[model samples]
Target: MGADGTPTVMVVDDHPIWRDAVARDLAEDGFNVVATADGVASARRRAAVVHPDVVLMDMRLPDGDGAQATAEVLAVSPSSKILVLSASDERDDVLEAVKAGATGYLVKSASKQELDDAVRATAEGRAVFTPGLAGLVLGEYRRIAKGPDATSAPSLTERETEILRYVAKGLTAKQIAARLSLSHRTVENHVQATFRKLQVANRVELARYAIEHGLDE
Candidate 1:
């Protein structure tokens, strides 16, 4: 963590100017800018040492692909959350990164404030997406769930189901709690239970499942 008890972060991008600017902005916002790397190898090497709370990764690196780097970094430090910062908004790229265990995806066109907030959200285990990509991902999940070989769906309580819908809509636990007239801790508990029932790791996967089953409607 940083001096102010803020989370630690690493910026990994092939472009020097962009990397430096992001690092500077995050550092100014009270994050501990632990390390900066320009490619996959360096990112993996440095990440093992620092184990930052959040890693801002570019999808295209000079030495290797960013999704592969995200997997490698997580292999070395499973607690670290990776947020893909890429120029591409292609559906395949986003899905590939998500499959590789990225906590979020953001495009290069995102504003500085958006990027900064995404890092913070990633560290807190929330799923972030660039604008319209969340719906694309949800649509893919829906298609898969509707396939002939789809298995029987997991059972969720009515409360859990409602919360899942809120999650699919990208509402945070606190926000959901506020809207539902429940305590934040109660909402978090429901979320964790929902995750276990669905066997998903984070909000993104849970949201995908909910959307796939038409619970988000």
Candidate 2:
């Protein structure tokens, strides 16, 4: 948490000027500006340390895509919320970020007030998207929801199910490992394998899987 009890945030855009501007605005809004990263590697490294409550990232970084970095960050800080803040509002970009476990998506054109509010909403676990993008994401999810039932879904090991319950409860991988008496790497491995088996792109979908299967109970 931040000094004012607001959530801590990380800005992960390659452009220093835009990144700094966002960071400054967030800081001014009483959010704890934890750290800023220019690329995927640095984002992962800083995120591991700060374990920020929310991450604001651009879709295209100098080294990689924001969606990929979102997955990597969640792999390390499972409880962190990622919010894609990019210039592009294309449907593909929005869906990709959501599939990558982003809690929200906002374009760079958003006003500082809008960005601040979105950050707060994301920290509280709300799925935020730039005006029209939210409808598209929801429609995609609804389409996917009709494709499979949890019962007929691919099978998972007992351990995967156990870890997934904690995931659904919003526990970080580190926290889940501590509770289950498992190594960090072991838990992460299970999560990755589960991702492959379920064909879910990221943690958000993983949570949905748990809910659909009643594992979240």
Best by TM-score: 1
lDDT of 1 by residue, 15-131 (tens): 999899989988887788999999989999999999999999888888888868988898898999888887654545555666677766788888878888888877787666542
Q: Taking the candidates one at a time, how many backbone clashes does each contain? A: 0, 0
For model 1, what is the alpha-carbon lDDT of residue 185?
Answer: 66
Query: Weakest 10 consecutive residues, lDDT, candidate 2?
Result: 207-216
Off by over 4 Å in 2: 142-217
lDDT of 2 by residue, 31-72 (tens): 899999999999999999999999998888888888789989
lDDT measured at residue 212 in model 2 versus the true structure, 0 to 100: 28
CA error at residue 77 for candidate 2, angstroms: 0.6
- Model 1 spans > 4 angstroms off: 152-217
